[model samples]
Target: MVGRLDGKVAMITGAASGIGLGTVELFVAEGAKVVAADIQDEKGAMLEKRFPGKVVYAHCDVTKEADIEAAVKKAKTEFGGLDILFNNAGISDRMSTITEITAEGWSWIFDILVRGPALGMKHTAPLML
Candidate 1:
């Protein structure tokens, strides 16, 4: 049977665990090659082994623009081009309330939740087009 994503290539952030891990599995099962981007080296390495040629692991800290750029490049170099960008990396402040959160905590969350995806989209748009 022809999978819906046959011949497609995807880059998924936070891919070492949780939703991103699930997505990597789904995309691969549907015949899409994947670039699994995350900070968890061991888990990310496991993904490469689990999927072999269908998945490439890229060490991506979403807060860093260079990391995002590198992951996008990996998708292009490894899979030829990107058909999808799953900007799924995220985190939460450990503080109990917003008032308890420090400026650094806010910046960190903003970097991951907002700046990260924005950078992902910015870098990935050219390949998708």
Candidate 2:
């Protein structure tokens, strides 16, 4: 039987490790062409090596629009067209309360967790649609 994602192209951010990495692995197993974007160059390289042609890596910081754009572009250029985008890049602040958080701390967490995903969707939704 053919794989469910045969001929589909997928882009996954934060894919160097953890959930992103797991997603990439599963996508590839299902025969989707995958672009794995992350800020961790070394780990990204390792993933590329492990998956060979099925997985490509882009060094991306999801907080930056340019990086997100480039990653999406790379997926299209490499795999023809984007069919799925997994905007899973994020960071968490383990701090206790809002009052305990400094202004800069709030900004940093929000930039990574909220703004980054928002920007990824803003850029990627059009492509997917």
Candidate 3:
């Protein structure tokens, strides 16, 4: 059967677990090649094994521009170009109260939530165009 995403390529961050992992599964099932980017080396390796040639694991920390850049490059090199960028790397603070959140916690959340997606876009926009 012809899949909807046949011949397309996607780069998905936070792809080692949770929603990201589910997305990877769905994308590959739909015939899209995926670059699965995450800090979880062990799980990422598993994803590669599960999907074989359809999924390439990229060890990426979204807060870092270099990591995001490298993942995008991997997509380009492996799949020839990028068709989608899912900036899904994120964190939820475990603090019970607003006052319980420390400056460091805020920084971590912001870096992952805001900076990560921005960098993902920055690196991926060129390839998307």
lDDT of each: 0.94, 0.87, 0.92
In candidate 3, which residue pairs clash? none
Model 3 segments more than 4 A misplaced = 93-96
TM-score of each: 0.96, 0.90, 0.95
Q: Candidate 1: global Cα-lDDT?
A: 0.94
**TM-score leader:** 1
lDDT for each residue of candidate 3 in 1-129, tens digit (9 for 90 to 100): 999999999999999999999999999999999999999999999999989999999999998889998999999999999999998887754544677878998888889889899999989999878
Report the C-alpha lDDT of model 2 over 11-78, residue by residue, as the tens digit. 89899988999999999999999999999999999998999999999999987889988998898788
lDDT at 7, model 3: 95
Summarize candidate 1's per-residue lDDT along 69-127 as a digit string, tens digits: 99999999998999999999987435447678788888888888999999999999999
For every model in order, what is the number of clashing pairs? 0, 0, 0
Pairwise TM-score winner, candidates 1 and 2: 1
